[model samples]
Target chain A: MAEPLLSIEELVVDYGRIRALKGISLSVGQGELVAVIGSNGAGKTTMMKTISGLLKPTSGRVMFDGKPLTGVPAHRVVKLGVAQVPEGRRVFAQQTVRDNLVLGAFLRLRSGQKREVAEDTERMFSIFPRLRERQDQLAGTLSGGEQQMLAIARALLSRPKLLLLDEPSMGLAPVIIDEVFALIERLKAARDTTLLLVEQLAFRALEVADRAYVIEQGSIKLAGSAKELLANPSVQQAYLGAAATH
Target chain B: MQTLQLLISGVAQGMIYALVAFGYNITFATSKTLNFSLGNFLMLGGVVGFILYMTHNWPFFAALAAVVLVGMVGGAVLLKVAVEPSLNQRSAYGWILATLAVGIVLRNAAEVFWSTDDFKFRSPLGDSPWRFFGEPQPDGSMSGGLGVYPQEVLIIFVSLAIVAAVELFKRRTVFGKAVVAVSEDKDTASLMGIDQKFVILFSFMLSTAIATVGGVLVAPITLVSATMGTVLGVKAYSASIIGGLESGFGVVVGGLFLGVSESLTARFVSTGYKDVPGFVVLVLLLLFKPSGLFGRAAIRKV
Candidate 1:
C-alpha cells in the first residue's frame, strides 16, 4: 500500500511507572476507517491522546503526514490537519452552538479563510440539522446525543486530514450510539478523511470498520479485516457475548 | 444633598475598585492564577504618571500613554518572571506566593528608588471641586449643594469605559473568544488549535495595564506613594471576590456596594469604621454563597 496517512512505531506510554501502552504499533491508510476496539483500561484512549499530542510517550514514534509528532503540543498538532473528538464529547459548554462551530474553524479563520470557514460552518449545520435549529442555544443545554453530534461537527469543521475519535459511544443511550455510528458510516462512505477510532463497544465498531485492532492489557491482541475478525472464534467469544468457558 | 454628594464620591471610589477588581478577574479566568502584584502595578502607574505629568511637565495624554506602556511591559515581565515558573512546577499554590512576592518586591523597589513619603498628584482636569447649585459669596467662595470633583467624574466615566470595552472585546472578537475557550477547557481548546499559553500571557498584560491606568486615574483623589496600592489592591481583590470572580457585572455591583457603604458609614459612623461594614458584609455573603453575587456554583463531575 502507498504510505499510510498515520503510522505508529512501537509506541510506549506510562502513567508514572504504570505502563498503559506497551510497544503498540498501528496504522491508518489514506481514506480508510480503522478501529481500535477494547475494554476499559486497554490503553486505547492513551494511544489516541499520544497521537493527538496531548500526552508524551516515554518511547516510540507517531508519524503523521510525513512528520514526527512526538513532543509537539496538542495546540500545534491540530494545526497540522489532525483533530480528535475527545472522549465524553467535550464541547465548549458555555458558548453558543454557533460559537462552538466557529471555534472549530479557529486556525482557518486566523489565516484569512473566513469565507471558507463560514461556508464550512453552514455545511456542518446542514449535516446536523439539529445544530442549525439550536445554533444560538448554549451547548451545555444540549442532550447527550446532541452534544456528541456537536462535538463531531466541531472537529469536522477543522477539515482534518486524519481524525482520531476516542469513544464516540461513551455515556450515550443505545439509540444515540446507533445515530453516532450511522454518522460515522456516512463519513466512511464519503471517503475523503482517514479515521482512527477507539471504542469499547467492540461489535458496534467492528460492524462499520474496514479493519479492526482488538487491544487487551495495553497491547494489540488481534488485528485483521473486520469480516475476518467477526468470523474469528476468540473475538466472538471474548467481545460478542458468545457462550464460552474462560 | 449631602447624601447625593456622598453617593457620587462613593460611586467614583467604588468604580476604581471595580476596575482593579476587573484586572484580577481577567488573569484568573485565563490562567486559574491571580496576579497578586496587580495593586503595585497600579502604584507604578501613579508614580510614573506623577513624575511625567507633574514633575517633568509632559502633556497629560502623553503621560497617560507612557503609563499604559509601562503597565503592559510590567505585566508581560510579571507573567514571565512570576507566573510561568510556578505553573511549570508541581505546587498548586506556587503562583500565589510568587505573585505576592513580586508585589512585595515592587513596593520595596518603589520605596527605595522613589520617596517613601506621600506626594500630591495634580489632576489633568484640575483639582478644584465643580460646584453645582452654588451661590457665590462675598469672599468668592461658592458655598453650595452637591459639590463634585472633576477628577471623580473622570474616574467614574473612565473606569466604566474600560470595563465595558473589555467585556465587549471578550464577547465580540474571535481572539477574545479564544481566551474564553482556554478558560473553559484548555485541553479541549487545544484540539481546536487555540494556544492557551499565549492566551494566559495576553490576559496578564491586559489585567495589569488596566490596574496601572486605574492608579493614574485615582492618584489625584488619593496620594502617590509606595503604600498606595497595598490597601487598594486588597480592597479591589475583595471587590472581585464579592462580585463573583467569573461575572463582569458582579464586580461593578460589589465595588459600588462597598464604595457607597463605606461613604455612608464614614459620614454617619466613625471614619475608622468605614472598612468594617463592607468586610462584615463580605464575610456574611460568602458564608451563604461562596461563589459571590452573579457567580455560578461550580459543579464537579464525579
Candidate 2:
C-alpha cells in the first residue's frame, strides 16, 4: 500500500478501433511476484506491452517507481528499470549466444560496465551451463527451453528493478515448461527483484505467484491471494486444466 | 599477361561497385530500406573531394577527411529528411520515392551549382601506371607488357580494408551487435534498451559515408560529373541484388564477377556490348536464386 513499485490506473489500450484493454488497474509491490493469468486474447500480452511502453494505453496511467511511464518509449522503459521478456522468446537469432548476452547488457555496457557485465554474463553461463558450452553457436540453434533461459538471462543482464515475463512457458515441452517455471521460482526465492508474470498457465502461475489476478475479456475478473484463488472452485473449473491452452 | 592485366582492372572496378553495394547492405540490414540515393552520396563525395584536393589545392588526406565528414553528414540528413518520415507513416513505397527524389535533386543541384561537364580527378598517387614487365621507352615510360594503374591498386586495397573493418566492427563490438539486434527485431531490440531509431539513423549515416568515400576513390578512374552516380548507382544496386543484399562477401563476389566479365567482354565480344553479360547473369541468377548467391532465405514465422 505504501507506493507500489508499479501501478496501473484504469489503463485502456486499443488495436486500431478495437479495444484491447478496456480499463485495467493493477499494482505490484517491491520484491513481489505477481501473476496475471488469462486465456489467449485476454489482453495479457497487451497489458505487459503497455506496462513496458511497447504500447501506449488510451486513457490511463502507468507509474513505475512513483514516476509516470505513460508515454515513454520501450527503449527508455528498459532504461527506467523495467524489462520485458516478450512472448515467443524473440532472441536475436543471427547472433551467437555470447553476443546475445552482451546485447542484453547493451545500455550498461555503454555506461562503462563492460567488466561488470562480463562477470554477470559468466554468472548467467554458470546458471545455464548449456549456454556456456554453446556460447559460440548462433542463438537460433538453441533449443526452445535454452532460448527461454537465454531470454530471461538477457533481460536479467539489464538489472531491471521490475521484470515482465510474458508467457515464459509458451511453445515449450511440458517438461521444459516445468523447468522454466522452476527457474522462475528460484528467481522468486532469490528475491533480488520484483516480477510480474503474464501467463496462460493459470495453475502453474498461481503456484509461483504470491498474489494473482484473473483477466478475461479485456478486464480483471478476479484479484486475490494465490492460495485463495487456487482454492476457489471457479478458478479451478475455468483454468486449472494444465494442458487446455497449450 | 593480358588476362592478368584485365583481371586486376576488373577487380578494382568491381571493388568500387562492391563498396557502394556494401553501403546499400548496411542500411538494408538495419532498417530494411535501401538508401536509393547512395550513388549520389558517392557523387557528393567525389565532387567535394575534387573541390578540396583538385580545385582548392588542399592536401589529399585533408580532402579525404573532409569528404568522409560530408558523407557522414549527408547520410544523417538523408535518414532524417527522406527515410524517417515515410517509415513513421508505415508507407513502404514512400521511402523509395523520397530517396529517389533526393538523388534527382542532388544531381540537378550539382549541374546548376557546379559544372555539368565531367572532370578528370588526378589521383594522389599520380597519373602513371605501374608496369610489371615492360621495355623502357625513350619517354622514360615502360612500353606495355602489363600496366596496372597505381590508382587501381589503391582502390582495391582501400575498398577491401573498408569492407573488412565494417564486418569486424559488426561482429566484435557491443554497439555493432545492437545494430544487428535491431535489424533482427526492432521491438525486441528496444526491450534490451537499444534505441532502434538511433540504430537506423546510424545505419543510414554509415551507409552514406561509405558511399561518399567510394565516390572519391572511384573518381580518379570514372571522372567526376554531376550525373556520374546515375548509371553507377544502378549497376551497384544490381551488384547488391546479385550478391545477396545482406551478405558482405556476396557483394564483393557479385562486384568482382560483374567487373571481370565486363573487362573480358569488352576485350573479346565488343566494347558496345560490355554491359550485356553482367545484366544477363543477374537476370539468370535471379531466376534461379532470388535471394542472391550467398543470401540466406529467411524462414518466415507467424
Candidate 3:
C-alpha cells in the first residue's frame, strides 16, 4: 500500500468527563475511501470532529500527509485541503444557495477574480444539477436531501484533497440516500479524492468504501476489507439485522 | 425664514445620526451585539480631529484622515478587549458593557485633555454660502432664496457619498462577500480560509470609521463636546434597528427618513418633542416589526 495520507494514531477524545474516543487508530492511503461504521454514540462523529479540528483530542495525534495536526484550528485545517461536510448539513440558512457555495472557497477568493469563483460554482452546479436549479434560493429552504447535496457541493468548492463526510445518508428518503451515495462513489472515482466517511448505513457505506472499521463505544472493534466486514457475523447481527445474519 | 433655516439644520443633524446608525448595523449584523459605546467613538472622532487640526496644526484633510485612522484603531481595540474575551467566555453582555466602559473612558479622557468647555469645529468647506435657491445676507446670515451654506451642502454630499461607497463595497467587493459569509455562518467562513478574526476586526473598524466621519462632518454645526455623540449614537442605533441592520441601503435610507421626519415633526409640531417621533418609531418597530423595515425575517431552525 502507498504511504498513508492520513494517520490517526491512538487518538482519544473527551467531552468534559466523558471519554468519547478511546485509543482508536486508523489510516487512509493517498487515494482511498475509508469508512468508519458505528451506531449513534459509537464515537464515529467524535473521531471525525477531532480530525477536522472542531474538537481537540486528549491524546495521540492526527497526522495528514506527514504534517502534525495537533491543536490546529478548524478553518486553518481547511487550508491544508481537509474539508469536512459536518453532520446535519448545517448550511447557512439565511444566505442564498450560491452564496453558500461561494463561502466554501472564501479564503482563496480575490476581489478581482469573481469570475473564477463563478466558474467553479458552475462546475459544482453541473455535478449536482439540482443545486443549479435553485442557485438563488435560500439554503435554509432546501429539503433535507437537497441540503445534504448542498453540504457536499459546498465542501467541493473548497477544492479539498481530503473529504470528510459525516452521516451523508442520515434523514433522507431511500431515493435521495441512493443519490447521495452515488455522488460519493462518483467523487471517489473521478476526483481521486481521499474520503474518511462515518456512517450508520454499514451496507451502503461499505459498497463505496475500500476498507471498513467497525467502532463500538469509541474503540475499533473490527477492521477488514469491505467484503470481510460485511461477512463478519457480529456486524451482521448488530448492524445489518436478522435478515443479514441468515 | 429663521425657522426654515433651523429645520434645514435639523435635517442636516439627522443625516449625521443616520450615519452613526450605519456603524451600529455593521457590528450588529456580524455578532448580534451592538456596541452601546458607539457614540463615544463618534465623539472621539471630533475630539481627535480637533486636536489634530488645532493643536497639531495639521491640514484639514490630514486631520480628517488621522481621526478616521484613530477611529479604526479604536474599533480594533474595542473588538480585542471587549468582543474577543466575551465571545470566548460565551458571555456576550460583557461586550456591550465593556464597549460602553471604553466609551466612557475615552470621553472622560477627552474632557480632561480638551477641558469641559465647548468649541466649534472649523468647517473645511469654508464659510461661503451656497444658493439653495438664495444666498446669505450681509449679516453672516443666509438670505435671498431658500439660503443654505456651502458647509451644509458638503455635509449632505459627504453623507450620501459614504452611503453610496458602502453600498458598492458590500455588493461588489470580495471582502464584502467574505463579510456576508461571516455573518451567515462564521464556522464555514473560517473553514474556507477567510480569517474569521480578521473579518471581525475589519467590520468593527469600517463601522467606526463611518460613525467617526459623521461626527467630524457635523461637529461644525453642533458643539464639539464630550457629550456630543451620546444621544446621537442612541438615535442612530434606533435607525439601524428600524432599517434592518443587514442591508446597507436600509441604513442610509433609515437615517435619511429619521432625519427628514424629525425635521418635519419639529416644524409642524413642537420643537422640544422632535426626538419623541424617533423614539416612538423605535418602540413601535420593536413591538410590531422587530426585524426593522429593511430587515428580512430570520426563521429559526432546530
Top candidate when judged by DockQ against the true structure: 2
Q: What is the C-alpha lDDT of each candidate?
A: 0.90, 0.91, 0.82
> Model 2: clashing residue pairs?
none
Q: Residue B233 in model 1: shift from native, Å? A: 0.8
lDDT of 3 by residue, B230-273 (tens): 88887788778788777766776677777877777777887788
Error of 2 at A229 (Å): 0.8
- By lDDT, the better pick of 2 and 3 is 2
In model 3, pairs of residues that clash are B134-B145, B136-B143, B137-B143
Docking class of 2: medium
Candidate 2 residue lDDT tens string, B1-302: 99999899999989989999999999999889888998898899999999999999999999999999998888888888888898899897899999999999998999999989999999999888889788889998888799999999999999999999999998899898998899889999999999998998888888888998999999999999998888888889999989999898899888888888889899989989989999998999889998899999653221
Report fnat, model 1. 0.62
Worst 10 residues of 3 chain B by lDDT: B127-136
What is candidate 1's CAPRI-style docking category based on DockQ?
medium
Q: Assess every candidate by TM-score.
A: 0.97, 0.98, 0.91
Q: B-chain TM-score, every candidate? A: 0.96, 0.96, 0.90
lDDT of 1 by residue, A87-145 (tens): 98888888888889888888988888999988988888888999999999988888889
